[model samples]
Target: MHEAKSQNISILSYLANRFDTPVMAHIAFVGINKSFLGHYVGAHEVMHDVMTKLNGTRRLGLPSRMIDRLILVFTVSCCWLAAWLDINVLSIVESFAGPAGAIILLLLPMYAVRRVPALAPYRGRISNVFVTVIGIFTVSAIFYGLLG
Candidate 1:
């Protein structure tokens, strides 16, 4: 919550500085409510997905409801600790965003197109090669920037 608020203010501050008008930033911030809600919804969905996958593994003897509660509590505690410790949010994002985005947005779609029967008809398109090349380049560039 604190991070989100600070991020919003920093964005608004950037807009104001860029435009040389606080009024414009305020106007833009009005439209930011949608983005703010989207972030929260995305986080919720990701957490739910994690819980679902962990429950499916059945490696733990715990009940599904108990596992979900435990995950929720753990997530909340981690968030609280990060906030209290003033961890650098951007560093955390930088560490995970590259690999996660590459896998989720790039690799998975390509895999589905190539291997899934329902998506088989879409395979062998020139766009697939183009997108794969672009995705690889983007991910490579991200890693290069992080490393160099």
Candidate 2:
């Protein structure tokens, strides 16, 4: 039991690192592990309960869904910041593509997601991607409008 828990923690840590966001990784781990550990620890008490127990105390925090949304927003903001900074790095793309191109880039992911049924199951991940694309485009447009 202890070994299994340790292994699960390791896996969660690995996933967290891979995602580059520990909170999101923890959310994923809780969501996925809730089902797997349900049988052993009662079906009614899963991730939330187990996490509380593991930590020895529960801390007040935003609900999981809210946290997920926040993560998406944060990711998008970061992407926007990156794109804004990239105007200095890739001036040529900004010069040629201009605001119109930026708008196209922003809307592209949303268009693809709506058109592609296969991406439905991964909506959360897709939303992150969409937001990122939108952020980049928005920043690019702003940069073009300001500089060009």
lDDT of 1 by residue, 97-130 (tens): 8878986898679888998999989999999998
Q: State the weakest 10-residue window (summed lDDT) of model 2.
A: 1-10
**lDDT leader:** 1
Give per-residue lDDT, candidate 1, residue 118. 97
lDDT of each: 0.74, 0.59
Per-residue lDDT of candidate 2, residues 1-148 (tens digit): 3443444344456667666887967786787667545543452245445544544555645566654455456556765896666434334444566665655666656656667898666556756576767768686667867776
Cα displacement (Å) at residue 30, model 1: 13
Which whole-number lDDT from 0 to 100 does residue 16 have in model 1? 75
Which portions of model 1 show Cα errors greater than 4 Å? Answer: 1-65, 94-106
Instruction: Give candidate 2's whole-model lDDT.
Output: 0.59
TM-score of each: 0.52, 0.23
| Cα lDDT over the full model 1 | 0.74
